[model samples]
Target: MSANIENFPGTPLSQADFDEGKILTTHWKPKLEYGWDAGVAISRYLAELKNGRLIGIKCNRCRRTVVPPRVVCEWCWEPMEAWVYLEDTGTVNTFSICYIRWDATRAKEPQIPAVIEIDGASRGAGILHLLDEVNADDVTIGMKVQAVWKPAEERSGSITDIKYFRPT
Candidate 1:
């Protein structure tokens, strides 16, 4: 049997031709910046992180503890006010193995990121953070983990304050 391969869309260029600049191409990088207000809850949350502590808010209506504390509870549409300290340790709720870097470059080793359900927070509440100091293949749901915070002086009231989570 014969195949018809000519009814394609646009022109196709070989890797060598593209790499050699045989094809006309223009690219430009955009300078972008972003600013965010942590607001009452999150600002306090990040601030506590800088002080080597974790905190959460409770939704009085649903009685669910919220992590990365928010100003309002989405569950009951009620204003969240009760604040509580959370444990640095938690369980991995879910995860991903990143084979590419943020810049889209191939990575030699995978980056493991997971939503860790903090021990003192609601059962399903978690914050997304990276994992390190362990092989990627060893990561598993429900795996116990703990935050590895940066040095106190290096903290800047940001999520990155906790460098990463590692198996406990």
Candidate 2:
């Protein structure tokens, strides 16, 4: 198939006419700084996670409990009622067996990623995390799992507080 290629109007450089010594290339190292506010819900959620506890919020209007405790309910558009403690053990709603790492690198074994529906949380209130301590072929929907948290002292007030989820 013939293809029409849009070439930038420029004099083409040929091997015979191009000289390595005539071209100047400078290397640049980029430096950047960034920060963000976690906001009320996420900040409290992270703090609770750092302390080895899971907390969520209840919406009176919608009659639903949500994880990562939000100040306002997404469904009913009202302020959430109160905070609620949640169990670490949960069920895997959906999952994927991946053969690549987050950094675009390959892996010898497949990694299992799943959406865990925390016990005592509302429907559709699942958290995304990796699965461990099980074979890739054994992972299935509705599988029971529990959070394997890092030591409290080593907790960094982030989702990484939980090392990974393992079968119960």
Q: What is the TM-score of each candidate against the true structure?
A: 0.82, 0.80
Alpha-carbon local distance difference test for all models: 0.92, 0.90
Q: Tens digits of per-residue lDDT for model 1 on 1-168? A: 137675766877899887998988889999898787768898899899999999999988999998989989998999999999999999999999999988999999888989999999989999999999989888999999999999999999889999999999
Q: What are the runs in model 1 whose C-alpha is more than 4 Å off?
A: 1-28
User: Which tens-of-lDDT digit does each residue in 1-168 have in candidate 2?
Assistant: 135667656876666454554555477988876788999899999999999988999998888998878899978999986899999989999999998988989988898899999999987799999999999889999999999999989999999999999999
- Residue pair clashes in candidate 2: none
C-alpha lDDT of residue 146 in model 1: 95
Q: How close is candidate 2 to the true structure, as a TM-score?
A: 0.80
- Model 1 clash pairs are none
Model 2 poorest 10 in a row by lDDT: 16-25
In model 2, what lDDT does residue 132 have?
Answer: 98
Q: For model 2, what is the error of residue 24's alpha carbon versus the real structure, in angstroms, after optimal superposition?
A: 12
